[model samples]
Target: MTETLSIGERVAWYRRRRGVPQEVLAGLVGRTADWLSKVENGRIELDRLSVIKSLADALDVQLGDLLAEPSLLDWTPDTLGGTVPKLREALMDYQQMSPLLASDSTSRPPDLEILRTEVGSTWSAYQDARYARATRLTPGILAVAQHAVRAYEGEQQREAQALLAMAYQGAAMVLTKIGEADLAWMAADRGLAAAQESGNLVVTGSLFRSVAHCLLANGRPTAARDLVVASVGYLENDLADASPTYLSIYGTLFLVGAMAAARIEDRAMVNQFLAEAEQTAQRLGHDANHMWTAFGPTNVAIHRISTAMELGDVQIAVDQGPRVDTSTLPLERRVRHTLELARAYSAQNRTDEALALVLDAEELAPEQVRHHFISRHLVTVWVRQRHGKPSHLLVGVAQRLRVIG
Candidate 1:
């Protein structure tokens, strides 16, 4: 007779099949490799519900699959008792739509009703955190979402698949912002896989564009460019012109292409791609907000300023930089925009204006100002040039920002 596997054994088996080395899997799930090894060997018990769920997610297995003891099925109902019903419900809900919540506009009311009923208490906890809770919940949410996608694969539920993909994408964005680049990439990969399997060309393109953006942020612009170029065929071939989602995805890809081109010092290609993005943006109807154009007009303008700065077009950067409404931009993006403006002013030999802009940005978000790549780089360059007396205003701003650090 075959030996029955415990939950730990099952988790280990699935993780191995997924080709995730213990060390890498442990790091992704925020556990020590040794501890994970002990858990797998059945020498150590995992009691924390969150940790168990995180493990299940990393292994791409259902939570029940990890917890199930096949030989224990003969035990009385009291053995598992009150938790069994909840576990069954969670499994069933995970099967239906654990990752993605149905959208009000896109989903049928009945389908939404089913999901709402099935998700139950879990949904409440998931949405409870109000402002900037990405740091706390992103990893757990991502794990849950990934597990949901794994469960629903090949089940012919297009809506469920799309929702799961969106969840993965959302989790990835949160992770990326929180400085978990590898985890962010993994989340993006899961989203891309689901998007491809669901045959949603718009989603597929958007996922790739997101992955490229992550890569670009992680300092691999070449890899980012390759991903974008690879995605173009899918975007052009499978996407319909009437689909605003598709157009928005294409426009984002072009925006990234322009940035990548600028990174590589290819001014001609950068201009060409930006022009293409502009044309695509023009074609987008009023409904483009539903697509991946979350950045929209302000974001595009910010990129224009950055690109102009990179291409030595100081006049263009200055003109467009001020046109962006700083109030509407996110704290991080606004800081970056201000830093770019500072760089533009510095390039124009207006050290006083550049320092003043930097000071303003520091006041908005001191932590953001301190860690900002462009601002730090610009200041370094300006200081090295010994551009006049070191401005007292800049010194005061730096001292205040240090308090937050």
Candidate 2:
């Protein structure tokens, strides 16, 4: 007979499968490894539904899969749906509390558990909306995240500050994906500031990496490189600790280095950075599954494709591009992979393939203005190579995009 696993045992099993040690998993989940061990052994119980769900997500399993009885498929709708609206209202109130707290300490404060409960509910709702691509929910979620940061700052709570910074970073990443570069940059900056004020070097370094990514996506390669270089000293010191945050920052710096080298047409530098990135990733393993480093393997592979194309290594690009599983990635990242493949195909004089890939990307993100910019850049390089006649399709798309004069 198969062993019956309690929720805690399921969590432990999944954590081990993910290659995360108990201590490391505990850090990511904001608890002690001893506590997690007791919970896994069924000697302790946790009442926070949100924490349980978060743990499930980190383990790449559904909440139902992690439960002992596993019979609550329909039960969540009643338990969660009825509470969402009130939770949303409470989250908003918490957001508003930041500004109030900044100005007036005499005001009575809600319990910490209350804030966590509401934030957890709001986060679950946001995740559902995110997967559905509900654009309307983004702004509201972002507002709440901003408020959380401000409130944490007002209260001078280190853990709260780190969590709030993460919330802002997640919002900014979504905004960036949806073609709001300016707003994303603003949010990233705010998160960085909060991280610095909290005196968490790990959070600060990670936020800098996010800022560099926004700069890179906006076509500011030089600025991005400078930001990455500035992060090197901090990352070097932090990496010795075996912290997941350090691994994330170190990997991100390598990615930034690869991109910068590609921009300047330095093949050797690109290869060096990619190699370093791979080494760091191997050392870190899946055990370091902090949200800060979620981009690891996928990010490294994407940059490798881009770098290979820039260096005219067509075979390398072709071989590596198809190995990536774009379906596991977000839509924004999938669009980027398509754009890179288009460029790589064009480099090999595969004009038809190039055009097909670009068309697919355009269709996927029709309303996203930045995709057009990327398309124009790829088309310009392909045109320069004299791979094909400048057809009406190219001219029409470019004109509609207004990216090319």
Candidate 3:
């Protein structure tokens, strides 16, 4: 019944249904009645997730109840919609819950090498920004990893646990990117559990990165930052003789911490985290993708741009964003950096450059820009703020993203 209405109209319907007056609802959400009226009348776009959530809380309703569009396929691919449920089912399967109950002939002596190859291939697809493909492959890999953990014992069991951790980490990464925040957290938590069972500190640190990302996706940046800090402290003494994988994961934690701090406007922590990450990058002495982290000197520089934006230092982001060369990075990293820079350009009202960058990102990965919150929000803003007939380029992008009819 609400499918045909704009988000504002939906809000209005809920407001009326709950018998909340405009002024009373507005006050509850810390807004004026006039503002609420504008929102309800579709005179304003509710773009911020935080504000949307606040409104939901005030109305005593689930967030999805207000956002229950008939389909996300206008922006999200069918691949995502189809695969997420499969991934969830795989994660919640009985085999993942207990190894004792999973002992059957079909699970006996599974090929570890084949499982490792499948896990690695899924991560590679994720790094390349083939998100839908990666998601499609996750369920099978997760199922195999679970079976391996169930079948093996002693040292082989530990090895199987490591594989399970990596598989869960990959699933978490894809889920986070596609805005499946709750499922992402579950995947990360499961990965962390597997990593601990494997008794691999490096893998544990890497899983901390995934957990921190889930925290950030769920708007708990402070918790994310603290987790990163604690994980780094736990791993700090090992860096003296750390392998490239250890260094990469260690440095990447600081980067994630910096981003988390930036979200809360914690300038001191942000600076401290960036400095630590940069020093680690210098120690490593080059760009590297150790353990699929894509962490090193170049990545540290990219984080600086990301943190600057998060801290609302838009000019700094604008100034330094274009200087980094991301060609050596994975396609996902490269496209992500491009989107951040485009966001900065839009903030500075350099609309042409922002649109061009958005187009460039689309050319590189059509699914990414369409599904990304940044590109979708920026395009929506551009379409709304335009005075006259919008440009064909802008219209085309918006249409593909389903920001407009």
Candidate 4:
């Protein structure tokens, strides 16, 4: 009956109500038991409306039943596989434990050097599209970083808090992508508070970027664009002497701003932000992942293609899709771009092209692409228009996405 149950949890609830075993239901739905398990645990997104309808038919219930939100879980600890619930517990646990530990001056904190490395690793997981796994790690990382902030001295304390801020931002980034906008906002707010305490401009801008991202996910790209436009000045400091880190974050913020403009179909703001992004990307000259922002010439070109898609210029997106070299992009970025290209192809009535891109993206990052809410929708739409049975290959992929029974 909860209003916020995630797609997976609702599926689980409906299945349980029907007294369906996971294996039996998987068989009925033409999906594997493992796939069903992942969906039930929230490892897979139940996004595509067609697939949800298919599930409703297979489970003998209304689609609305499976679409209901989950019962919110408290941190008092019943086991949870979903990331955000566990994150809530970790955040609450750290807030309580850090202050108590800080009261005792003699208690030794975690190693600062190690914590920094873990923060870097956490970012890697996020960039690789291991979103759920990243969420699972972030709260613990945040807790440790917070502990270090209280226990360390002077410069070390600042670095600890900054790393703590990064952890929160990482949580926000992953959560937003996974459709947890409210929780993403909470994590972003936490990051901003910690960044302010650390007095780091780079962290502050990065956290602002996270806040903007949460806004976009909540379907307010105009507000998101406004946020990026207003806060653009925050990163302007030290541009002349900007390190690769600064250039990367600066370019990424504009890239985000450009994306926001695209979502709301604000062509003028999109061009302006993209122009600014181009300047920053050109300054870098080549692809470089400074602070995991992955800002550079190639990334800028990719964003241009994405922008065109957002603007409903499908021809432009299709034209640009083949020209760009995708070899240099990260797995997650490449997969997302490929999927976006598929969307463009779909829009253009190029079913074969769209299907190819979807398959390629799925091959590259199955967990990311196949489990996305959009993936199912894409596959479902693709299937419905076929002259007859699709090729075996397409059906295999559709089956994996649970788009066909």
TM-score winner:
3
Local accuracy of candidate 4 as per-residue lDDT tens digits, 1-405? 543345666778888988999998888878999999997775564543445655776788754455431112222222246556778777667443467644545668889889989988778887787766687678778877877888878888888888888888888887766556677788888888988888888888888888888776655677889999878886786799988888888888898899888876678988999999999888877899877787888788888988887676879989888788868877777877788788878877787888888888887766576445456556765565567988887788877765565
Best by lDDT: 3
lDDT of 1 by residue, 258-347 (tens): 787776667887888787777777777332344435345666677888888766678998887888885654465667788889888877
Clashing pairs in 2: none
CA lDDT of every candidate: 0.59, 0.59, 0.83, 0.75
lDDT of 3: 0.83
- Give the range where candidate 4 is weakest over 10 consecutive residues by summed lDDT: 69-78
TM-score of every candidate relative to the true structure:
0.59, 0.57, 0.86, 0.77
CA error at residue 125 for candidate 1, angstroms: 17
| lDDT digits (tens) for residues 124-164 of candidate 3 | 98887777778888998887788787778999989999999
In model 3, where do residues sit more than 4 Å from their true spots? 1-82, 106-108
> Residue 283 in candidate 1 has what lDDT?
73
- Candidate 2 residue runs with Cα over 4 Å from true position: 1-139, 142-156, 174-181, 217-219, 286-289, 325-331, 358-372, 376-405
Q: What's the best-to-worst order under TM-score?
A: 3, 4, 1, 2
